[model samples]
Target: MIQRFIELGEGYGDIFEICELARTNADRLEQAFIMYANHNDKQVASLAISLKPVGDSKFMPIYLCREGIPYNAEKPSQRLAIFEEALAQLNVVPNRFEIKHSSIFSENNLYYQYLIGILRLNHYIPPMH
Candidate 1:
């Protein structure tokens, strides 16, 4: 199986888009997760939803709002709240994890690859077949 992060222009109006994707594809929704990273000394987060492959396809699309929302557990950002509210409607709660900031990687693609590896290792996503 092949999994890829389909970036949705960070945390902006795209947050709504991500939520829409998950809601519209609720049946295919595999997982919802938040990754927190420290970028430029500020804690930020990326919200993503994993969708199952369609019709025996090998591609699993992970819709992501890469490192945009400010991370705050004590008082979650409104953006995060919006995402949670959307998921709540679908009875889905997001799993959270801390990750190396994208800035550490030379390219976004490399960072995504690293995240995919981590997901596989944690069993959040399937391993290579």
Candidate 2:
């Protein structure tokens, strides 16, 4: 199957959109994830929602708010809190992963490909058929 990341704007608003997408498509939702990475020595996260492939379509869409939130274990922010609350409503807790920051990639598409590889390796997304 083909998998791709669809990027949304960064912040709480985008997180809400991601959550809504998952909630609305819960039957087809494969996984909800928060990808964390260090950029410029600061922690940042991207919220992603993966959906199952449609009939005859190998492509799976992964919606994301790319590298926007500050990642802190001890400190929390309203943006992340909203995501957590939304996930609770959907009855699915997000799976977290530390990854290579997108900034390291020269192109945005490459960054997404890297993420897709990670997801496939983790079995979050299906492999090629």
TM-score per candidate, chains pooled? 0.95, 0.93
Clashing pairs for predicted structure model 1, backbone only: none
Q: lDDT of each model, Cα atoms only? A: 0.91, 0.85
* Tens-digit lDDT string for candidate 1 (48-113): 999999997999999999888898789999999999999999999888899999888999899999
Off by over 4 Å in 1: none
Count steric clashes of candidate 2: 2
lDDT score, residue 1, model 1?
Answer: 96
Candidate 2 regions exceeding 4 Å error are none
Model 2 local distance difference test score: 0.85
Instruction: Return the top candidate by TM-score.
Output: 1
